[model samples]
Target: MSIDDTIGVLLVDDHPVVREGLSSILESADGITVVGQAGSGEEAIVLAGALTPDIVLLDLRMGGMDGAEATGHIMRQSPGTKVVIVTTYDSDTDILRAVEAGAAGYLLKGSSRAELIAAVHAAARGETVLTPSLAPKLFQARAKEPPPLTEREREVLQLVSRGLTNADIGRRLFISEATVKTYLMRTFKKLSVSDRTAAVITALEQGLLP
Candidate 1:
């Protein structure tokens, strides 16, 4: 690729040695350039705004503004820039947080050199990259996550928890009994329960209702 077509990358890590190693590996490849390096997430955000690099390889843990938080800032400051998290963390919480914060990729630091290069290219192409072993963890975490409940649904569930019938709930909320039933049905579906008791129990367990 021509110089203009080359991908610009910004490396963010707390350790200078880590940055140097990453730069060396990436610079050894053609069509990829390490444009800048930052010692912290705070610095990463500044350089990201200034350089507007095509990709940012970020570390999850830093002195301040951890990788997930930094990813959010970088995305807002430079919408065209793709942030790829390069971290040693592979926990479900860590991976989910980074992904939810608008990361383009999540790669473990233990990844092979070839995998790292491939992930960078994939992220620049607008693909969601995850360490091969972490994909299942991500999917399982998402599956186990409770569906978000609407305010009205929570209100209905809360009343149900108090032993209120559909009619009583409708009267309390100033809605028709049929409307209350509709809300309950919707809540049941969302909570994946077939009955009111099951729905209430599931909601309580998931903290969807107080």
Candidate 2:
């Protein structure tokens, strides 16, 4: 198909069900086609560079290489390809990091079919989409009291917002799970919040690490 006439999309997610489901959704729409699908971030980078799809629908939480890393690599390799983070996470840092990673839009997994379709269309049109619930936090990101995290604390917090479990964070950061918990506990106290969700919110507000 001609570039001007068709929107080529690549789906990057670990789950086969999600890949097929999104493929079905996009394929049924006129003027769009599922050019390829990737089950992990490494595959996504390769396919995105090779296929040069117009847009990529990426899941944030694959086991090894996550969406943010893939998005960054795609931006570097295929500058024209737009990415939309299709994630279960709505945490402020996750949304912001995807944005910083050069995603064109962020769509929660809870988004309706129409919402997903609209997001893809908008993304193809070079528009950004942040869900309504998240738009408030995104828009007011500069307005919150910043969390006072140490350098290590900040690093852990960023990964935490990406939906990484403490174990995952420990693996990524090369810290013990116990150490991860300790850092997170200190981060929570510093942020003046008591949990993972609130700490992420506080980080976004305070400009601690976006």
Candidate 3:
């Protein structure tokens, strides 16, 4: 792309040194510009909305809001902006949560300069990027084993198995009926089943229920 077509980037990291280093690296690359930096997730969301960067490099862990929550807000605030998580974490849970929160890419902080540059361009073009080490984990999380159900989901499933209606389940779980439905839906996806009856049966068959 031409210089005028440069991809705008916002770096979000809790560490000033990390943000400075990334800003320098990304700014030196062709067709990329460091538009802003933020030290926390809350600030990142605000900058993302204001700057409307082509890509936002977000840290997964921060003092408050965290990357996932910030990502969700950023996406809502600027739907056209892409979010690329650049964090020290590479766990399956971290990757899945970031993706579920609408991240366009996930790369470890240890990624090489070349990888980082490429990821920025790719993310700006709306392509997903992941470090090689993280790719397998995400794929496995999506396809290999069933997603580990959340504790809330387990409770919802057990209540469903006990012939409780959504209202009863909500009261028993001390959550709203809508929240109970949400938990059930998430459980259904995790168990790879449809409907309450199917989810309950699958959970029992897989020994996922107590």
Models ranked on TM-score: 3, 1, 2
Please write out the lDDT profile of model 3 over residues 77-132, one tens digit for every residue: 79999999999988887788688678999999889999999999888777888898
Taken over the whole model, the C-alpha lDDT of each candidate is: 0.88, 0.85, 0.85
Per-model C-alpha RMSD: 11.2, 8.4, 8.4
Clashes of 1: 0
What TM-score number comes out for model 2? Answer: 0.68
**How many backbone clashes are present in model 2?**
3
**Which residue pairs show collisions in model 2?**
144-205, 145-206, 146-206
Q: Tens digits of per-residue lDDT for model 1 on 70-141?
A: 887788789999999999989887787688768999999999999999998898889999998999989877
Better of 1 and 3 by TM-score: 3
Best by TM-score: 3
Which ten-residue region of model 3 has the weakest summed lDDT? 189-198
Report the CA-based lDDT of candidate 2 relative to the real structure.
0.85
Q: Write the per-residue lDDT of candidate 2 for residues 152-202, one digit (tens) a residue.
A: 999999998899999999999898999999999998666544568867865
